[model samples]
Target: MSTLTVILLSIISLMYSCKDNNTAQSEDIKEIKSSEATTQLSPNTTTTKDTISIDKSTKTNTFTSSPLDLLKQNEKAIVTLFQEASPSVVFITTSVYQRDYWSRNVYEIPRGTGSGFIWDEDGHVVTNYHVIKDASKAEITLSDHSTWQAELVGVAKEKDIAVLKIDAPKEKLKAIKKGSSNNLIVGQFVMAIGNPYGLDHTLTTGVISALGREIQSQARIPIRDIIQTDAAINPGNSGGPLLNSSGELIGVNSAIYSPSGASSGIGFAIPVDVVKWVVNDILKYGEVRRPVIGVSMVAENYTKGFGIEKGALISSIFPDSPASKSGLQGMTNSRLGDVIVSLDDKEIKNNTDLILALEKYKPGDKVKLTVLRNNKEMEIDLTLGSSN
Candidate 1:
């Protein structure tokens, strides 16, 4: 061959070798990227990773778990809660007897239905007073679908709490675990299990929207220190237990703020603090024992008309009782009397204050009181008496 032909052939061979080397390097790089991306997906996945970039700002909070696995875990937790709590819940059906004018037959008429929870191993059911109120009798359906006739154990109508007892075996009764509602904060998660609208065990979830609400009881007494939640509470939900995420009983579902008488997202529950007190009292005293100071407070309007802005004015005093014997005087013909302004270290601004303060103590406990009598302030050490 010629010298120019030999030189050209060598240059062409060198160029072809470099091109092949570049292609091999490109294939090796592609294999490495494919291996790294394979860890993020399974064989059955069709999701595209290009648009699924993880934001670095949320790196600390980002989940490194498989979505399906996380979903399964959450579903397991919810199922466990329902299974653990449903045993403590019961369905209450109330009935009354009505006489037919035409038939002269006393037929059992169904009044309403509500929910309750077992309170103790003795098959004691705790529910709202208005639920079993005025009903001739009630039938309790246990979690096992066993029906039992319930007998009234005791009731606190002022607080709208009632207890019923069934003759079931201890193995059939599952008492709920109690939790505190006093330290609850807004936005904390809560769960409500009840028979809303008489549909068997229904579960609703929500958060504590607010706290320290007030509602009226069937006895016309004010129920204070209520916990407000967004949990759906309807008519049948009354007497059901309101629970925290841990499945502990925190409150008793009582009233709702819906104009249509349904779940309005504004539901009030009787705090467990009050429930504990009432349940203890009923189990001991057969009813709520109110501590009385033996003095009736003046009408709020009557006291306000005299330019008295604070304190509950004394209207009348039960003769020979704590207030009367303690030299406490009441309003005479001129509507002038002693005004209770404080009890111990707590301030009593109105009748509500006085009543609530009295609730903290039992009968025969000595309490110090500060009252305004005839525009003069004085302190009295009085013995608290019971209105039993």
Candidate 2:
């Protein structure tokens, strides 16, 4: 064999072997890519890390909890009380008629809002006098969401109470059960239901902080036997019922002592006992039948100017009146008139005292008056007359 032929043969064989090796390597690479694609497309297959994560996510987290406790006795009582009493509560909104300057058209504009309650089946609603004060008309919204126009029945300004009549059906009216305030004691629980700040049917609970409290009415007359409570009474709570533990109306929420015009835990209510008589008189006569002494009393300032420290000074006596029949004298330019120092053994410090004392009596009732005449105290008998 020739040397050149041997070298050529060896080079050709080495080239063919290298080509086959390259082809085999290409096939192996293609298989590896196909396997990777299959692994990615198969939903039944997962990597070890992925399987661990999937198993954790499928498990739900468990939590342990304590059982809820039932409501206490007082709590249950309050709930039941509210449910029974709230239906009798009503919301009152007052409006004033105004005439537009340019159009000259009269229309009603909202004035304010307050609370009231159904007084009887005849559709009589009772509320605070100040709530409807300066208002031309009012609307009463019952707890059942029925609204009705109300007419002014009567008012006792000195008592801070006003009665309104509605034309609603008797079936819709729910008269509140009345309770006695004369038997009420301090520290007894009281629940007040009203619309505070226009939020209807709001209930506030507190104990009677005091009894026999005195508060001024809208007419500046002193309202005796007022109820003081710690319940939350705001602007719109006026005229709502103050209920005792038995869910009976004991008083009517009237005023609150707060500098910021909000409840300060000091609230006042007109006792239901006083309310009964005042309401009866109003319903019967369209006005309070307060007994009249038929004598006009001078102002406090006028009495003070005359060196009178106390007692209600007689300003003038009406003709054919009770005072005239009793010979009660008035003050003259040179002499001080008779000043009532006492009435029926009750000290008459001022006109307010005299007025309050006379409230306990009815017309034609005889009363003894202690008068200061000519710097000497004397007694006189007089018969009370009805202003009605």
**Which has the greatest lDDT?**
2
- TM-scores of the models, in the given order? 0.81, 0.81
**Deviation in Å, model 1, residue 261 alpha carbon:** 1.7
Note the Cα lDDT for every prediction shown. 0.89, 0.92
- Candidate 2 lDDT over 102-178, as tens digits, reads 99999999999999999999999999999999899999999999999999999999999999999999999999999
- Flag clash pairs in model 2: none
Worst 10 residues of 1 by lDDT: 53-62
- Alpha carbon lDDT at 57, candidate 1: 43
Model 2 misplacement above 4 A: 1-71
Pick out the ten consecutive residues of candidate 2 with the lowest summed lDDT.
49-58
Model 1 per-residue lDDT tens digits across residues 187-226: 9988899998889799988899999889998977789889
Residue 125's lDDT in candidate 2? 95
Model 2, position 277: C-alpha lDDT score: 90
The count of backbone overlaps in candidate 1 is: 0
